[model samples]
Target: MSTEDIDVMVYDYTVAHGAIPAPLNFMGFPKSCCTSVNEEVCHGIPDKSVILKSGDIINVDVSTIYKGYYSDASRMFMIGKVDKKKQDLVAITKECLRIGIEAAKPWAFMGNIGAAIGNYAHKRGYSVVREFGGHGVGVEFHEEPFVCHVGKKNTGMLLVPGMIFTIEPMINMGKKDIYVDAANDWTALTIDGMPSAQWEHTVLITEKGAVSLTY
Candidate 1:
């Protein structure tokens, strides 16, 4: 299936389960899914007023509960013909996510995941958002083992089989500083007003490697 098909599936899953299946109620998110577009860093609630345009980039974040288990993942996509710079940023961001996932294994430190992502972003002259990072996911919505996007090796939690979580890397075109939309209480944007991109995957660490649950 295409990337668009996967996104639709995720959206449907979230909608079918409704807000009750999401743990955001405890955090006061007030939304079932997040569809953030250009200039909208994260937590962008989908709405009719927000229509995707041809050169726009969007990130769809979805989380759902199934059989008492919760799964979450996100993907970034280009609406149509976006500029080369933005396209490169999006491509590189996805690669960073891939590299992070590759480093997620049994006995691996959570910081290694962030180190891989951060190093790639920095080498490409981009900054990773340090405020919001990955976290453990499983029976509950969000759990232990906080994963920072920028950290030193062997600094944080250790990865082990049976551990499920997400590794989302938010790359900024300019500075790492971010701003939240107080009025809507959802949207997040870069303080410098530069474009940003992000990619995420709900992963489960197996005896061998990590499996993407929401793929």
Candidate 2:
């Protein structure tokens, strides 16, 4: 489906549930959802100008505001007849997200989240995007305690119960450097023109372990 169609679908769904798309009006963002394909990294604008093709891997990011609360998440989708390398990138990117979440625990340092994800991605010959990691979100669209996807363990903020945030890792098959498209100034593209994949979920820190609010 076109990105515009996806945006409408999400907008309607949110309204049906007495909610709203958080990105719809925030910071002048034009779409209800973000659709990033292939080399595109994040904040891609939904437009009728672009169309999905076979073998393409697309990342659909969705965030919703409901009852003064917010939840954010994203997932990758492979079009028909994808290559093994691209397929593996998607799978590994998801695994990176899982690894980060697994490391989030009470009293643990926030840096552990990125260290776990970064180490795994590096070991697999992939680079994690350090420019944009994750952030706290709940009553607002974006908040404090920026979560980095690349850092040293036992550093940064100390994890505590009742903290809400997201762990979204953007993994690149090529170099981690990225550039924003000048035309729109929103879509971020990998500099090497190689494939990139990302996975995200909002989570809540609990006394026991991390609970995925957007799972």
Candidate 3:
């Protein structure tokens, strides 16, 4: 489906549940959902002119505010006929998110989450984007705790039960550097122009473990 089509779908789905799309009119954002394709790292501006094609990897980020609380999540899509290399990137990128979430147990340091994700990504010859990692969410669209995807272990804030946040690691097939589009300032592109994939889920720290709020 086209980006605009997906945006409308998101709007209708959210409204059906009496919730509003958080990204719509959020800080002047025009769309209800974000559709990032290929080298576009994040915050992609949806346009009807852009259509999905075979072998293309796309990330769709959705955020909604329901009843006074917020939830955010994203997933990567491998367009028809995706190659093995790209498929591996998507798989590993998802594993990175899982590792980070698993590291967010009670009494754990925030940096442990990043370290686990970064180490695994590096071992697989992928680089994690540092410009945008993750953030707390619930009362507001974005909050504290500032979850980083790459950092030294045992640093940052300690994870405590009841804290909610997102763990999205943007893995790049090339260098980790990125540049913002001068024309839009919102779309982020890889400096090396290689494919990037990301997965996100709003998580809540609990006594047992991290639970995904957007699941």
Compute the lDDT for candidate 2: 0.93
lDDT by residue (72-169, candidate 3, tens digit) is 99999999999998899999999999999999999989999999999999999999999998999988999997889998899989899999999999
lDDT of each: 0.81, 0.93, 0.93
* Model 2: worst 10 consecutive residues (lDDT sum): 1-10
Point out where model 3 deviates above 4 Å: none
Residue 115 accuracy (lDDT) in model 2: 94
For model 1, which pairs clash? none
Looking at model 3, the pairs that clash are none
- 162, model 1: CA deviation in Å? 1.2
**In model 3, what is the error at residue 167, expressed in angstroms?**
0.4
For candidate 1, what is the lDDT?
0.81
TM-score for candidate 2, residues paired by index: 0.98
lDDT of 1 by residue, 1-215 (tens): 23344445555675675633363454786556677787777877666556677888888787777777777888898987999988988999999999999988788888889888999899999999987878888778778877788877787787889888899999998999998888976689999988889899988899898888878
